[model samples]
Target: MALVGPEEPHYCNHHVVASTGRTRKMTLVRALRPFRVVRRTLAVFTLGAMVIVSFALLPSNVADAATVPVSTQAVVQTAPDLAKICARLKITVARTSLCSHGPDPVDAFGGGARLKQTSAVQEQGVAAAPASELTALCNADGVSGKRIEVIYGVPQDRTNRFSAMVAPLRDMMRQVNNNLEAADAATSQNYRFLCTNGVDVTVRNVTLLPVGSDASFTFDDYVASLQNQIAFGLGPVDFIANERLYIAYIDQVQDSYPFGGQGELSIDDQPSAAANANNDSRPRYSMSAYLDMPVMAHEIGHNIGAVQDSAPHSSKGGHCYDEADLMCYDDGGLYFALGGTLTFTCPGADTAIDCHDEDYYYPGTPPASNYLATHWNTANSGFLTPVVSAATPPTVTGKSPVSQATRVAQTANATATFSEAVQGVSTTTMRIKNPGGTVLSSAVSYNTTTRVATINPSASLAADTKYSVSLTGGVTGIRDLSGSPLVSTGWSFTTGPAPTITTRTPGSGATGASRTASVSVTFSEGMAGVAASTFKLKNTATGAAITALVSRNGTTNQWILNPSATLAATTNFTVTITGGSTAVRDLAGNPVSTSIWRFTTGS
Candidate 1:
């Protein structure tokens, strides 16, 4: 595949503690062996802080993702752990441990994205008010668009404390969202985090994480228990499956040393039924509680798809290769494969995404050849904001063949070129019909790159016929990307004249022609097909047709009549091009009229 991108990564919003001014050197060694199971929920990369970069490549066709909805099921079907699952599918998997950081820490509390809550503060059923400074961090009232739904979960023995921390979580996410906006200023787009839309949305007392009496629980255990109890976010329904990124705030940590959080990497949401399975679709609910806002950001990054293996700096383990960005790490994510080293290139703020813009997030339109343009981009995730505006955008015409034009080609298809990208291209929307209003059997197709929609007729148009093209629909019809319709009476044109003999080899009534000579003829227009019965060579004296093989040259538009036996020497022979709609015809179905010519052959 030809990858189109800048040789070096785009350094747009470089937020780093130190600009070492280092150039990231890379040696790309394709898989030494076959690629095996690489987890979407990869190892947490932490410099005493939690982090996870989700990685998955999305489908290419969908205009916008319709996320899977959460279903009201009592129990969720759980799959085997990553290794076992891969084994069943006959894939070899080897575990690689990767976690480190870029620049030295400046703050004692330090910085990390996605993590565990250090303290379990208690409160009543109501939520705790945020610190005055954190109030503006979130907007929960009118802008109540889609967000990450937070749940309060604890071991059966422990009390749930997330109910008290709703505002704080929202505020933390608000801070992350705001930081994303700042990073994306170059793209001219605002960013928002997945948060509780309106009120403090929390599902309390779902399932229990392993604690107290429970023995050695794996990371998967925590997610499974909670998933079994919470009755939503299964999928299929658009909003339910996709609208919310369901995450739970568990009050306790597990025996597992790396207990920040993890999520399934849907990569890019491939909308097909099989591709959109279990957690494979929606980053379907795995990551858990962490007071650090960036931790949530990093963990959620996995759920929505980021850091594809094909990315320039990708670690191949679902994390980025460089340092200082939220997903990048000091201990190369692809340690065993890439020699386990990363240069401290683009040092970034606590909320950094890719060290450079080439890995995951791109605010503006990406180059058609850029990695972000093809892979799943976190910025396109449905959980972000401001919600896409519902307003309809108009579709304007760029150009088309003028109406009432004459001598149009019989086999030419009709097209409408638009100045802007359009959406509707179904047969019902873009149309081709006879002047009498009879719709023709045709298919409609649109090319986004060229901004053109075409009407391809099933068969060629008839010769000397008038056909009309029209686009219909109000705001909802043959519309632009923004839902504005292409409402036009369209245009029409008339096909050119009928087919006639343009060339005849061996002149009419010519005498002394060689008996072995083959007869040839050409037509004025390109023919749809040549009929065997239409070409003939016969001895005029005997009144019998000559056995001959007829062959046509489409490129030269010539038909050759070769007799099986040599023509009778010194005999008068006749040649004919039989015609009518059923015989030799042009693409427009216009026939070549029956034509005859006679010649006497020489011995």
Candidate 2:
């Protein structure tokens, strides 16, 4: 199926939606990122703010946080900021007297309007009493003042102190923003900012307050009391204007303490009411910037064009460690990217590089940057322009004359120099297609900052054959860190004859039913032909290999035999050839990479 665009969810593909094992709409909703709720809610936060807030302060050691199998306990422990968390969430709020709506929040799509409310004070599915009320409920339950102090941070004895405490955090946010912007420029990939017609950002000022400390809910209450005020109190008009993003702030109803030795981003979720109630009087608390910030961006990133990783339920979506997926459930508070963080390479040692991981930032130990940059300054640096001309495919005018081949037991090394560091075509996307149109294997891999995909086929190449390596669709998905797709068309090349195979040294042998053995096959030609390590010897039973090995006689085509261990006696064996059949020709310009034959070992 064609790739789904950002605004157009993957669910649009009937194949994807139906195959996910759910009703269509629900699958579509599932296809959206976790932040989809936030994106659909806020719709107008700043892109820069989103990136910084999401990635900065991620602690490095969150993997060690307390674990609770139960969802309630998990939520509480994972979100330690719950006590300090006030629902400043911008929701549609209205008083009962002037409004027909009830106090409960609405799930409009779920036919929430049909749900009945018994009283004016009653909460609709979507609406709720003011946050102040929530705070009162939290405090009356015996939550402590110290926890409250942690949530609001001493309420600033004076404006100066308030600014003093918030300034450093603000500076940290700014640094994160700058880093993202630079990386975006370097990679030419869009970051938090989305550019469909115009740029759309997601974020806003967040505030936190201790619950039940005051008789009134402070400014948040006033905002919540507005005629059409929504829950969490963000105005509805703001959302209407930036329909693609979300802007939200933080507020808590009760007192909570920030966890020590953890970055604000590194903090875990607050414990639930039941868990907190069972604790001591000094009630501990935690406000997670890690979960919060990424959640913010995750919501916003959903607004941008990227497919939701709705693979959790499908076997086809096997890799749970898809850090590149914004919709990946595992990405919750851990991830470095704002809009475009999916990477081909693994994340570095720095945990805070993403949102949910350890967010604690200290000097000298900086978070790892995504290899691909997300933005490009068109006016300053012209990296946005195409690097290669579209006139024709690049021709291989010269090649590295040095060539070496080895048996499965030995390592073969070869390096070819390109005319230039060609753009568009990445090493990872390069595939070696056989004459039968079957792809032997991909010849690309993501290495360091560059795409350096290589392949040592599972089977050996035949002797003296001419093979062709055609490059088709080799540069489509490859983008620089700045998110620019490869500009040039794909290219390929044909190589010289394959090395000659002499004879197997231990020709036609069997073992005493040993499980593992490295079987080696030698070649008669020089060890300068195609890669020979790709050969394999398989057992007839389950088509499994007995750890057979292959090696060349350093100078001649004489190959050696060695298996990881001895093989089973009287076992049926078949040789499977693979690497590049077309790329590896036999002595008479014939491809033999696919030639397979069977033999029996002595019992």
Which prediction has the highest lDDT against the true structure?
1
- Which runs of model 2 end up more than 4 angstroms from their true locations? 1-162, 165-186, 189-210, 213-299, 302-320, 324-345, 349-603
TM-score against native, each model: 0.40, 0.23
Q: Write the per-residue lDDT of candidate 1 for residues 1-603, one digit (tens) a residue.
A: 011124211110010110111112222122211111121122221222122221221111112322112221112112224333323222221111111111111111121110111222112221332222122223345234445655555655455565455555544444344445435323322232332333332333354533433233333344434333332222112222344556655555533323455544422222222332222322245444445545556666665565554566655445654555666543223332334444456633434667577777765556887666655556665455432221333333433554434557878888877656777667877777663346789988988898888889999987766676656534546667666544333445667776788888777988999888788888886764354566878889888989888887658788888888888888898888876433455554345667899989988
The Cα error of candidate 1 at residue 277, in Å, is: 8.6
Best model per TM-score? 1
Where in model 1 is the C-alpha error above 4 Å?
1-147, 187-205, 230-243, 254-257, 267-283, 330-336, 386-603
lDDT of each: 0.48, 0.26
Task: Report the error of model 1 at residue 10, Å.
Answer: 26
Model 2, 1-603: lDDT tens digits are 223234322122111000001111211122431223333323233222233223221111123222212321111123233222211112222211100000101111011111111111111121211221112112222221211111112211112223322322222222222222222111211122212222111122333222222221222222222222233222333111211122222222212211101111111212222222112132111122221222222222222211112211110111112332222222212122212222222232111122221111111222445111211111111111122231232322222221112121212212232322344443334443332234454344333333333444445433232122322222244334443333211122224444444454234444343334444555434332233344667777789865644665476544444666666677777665443321333333233344455666666
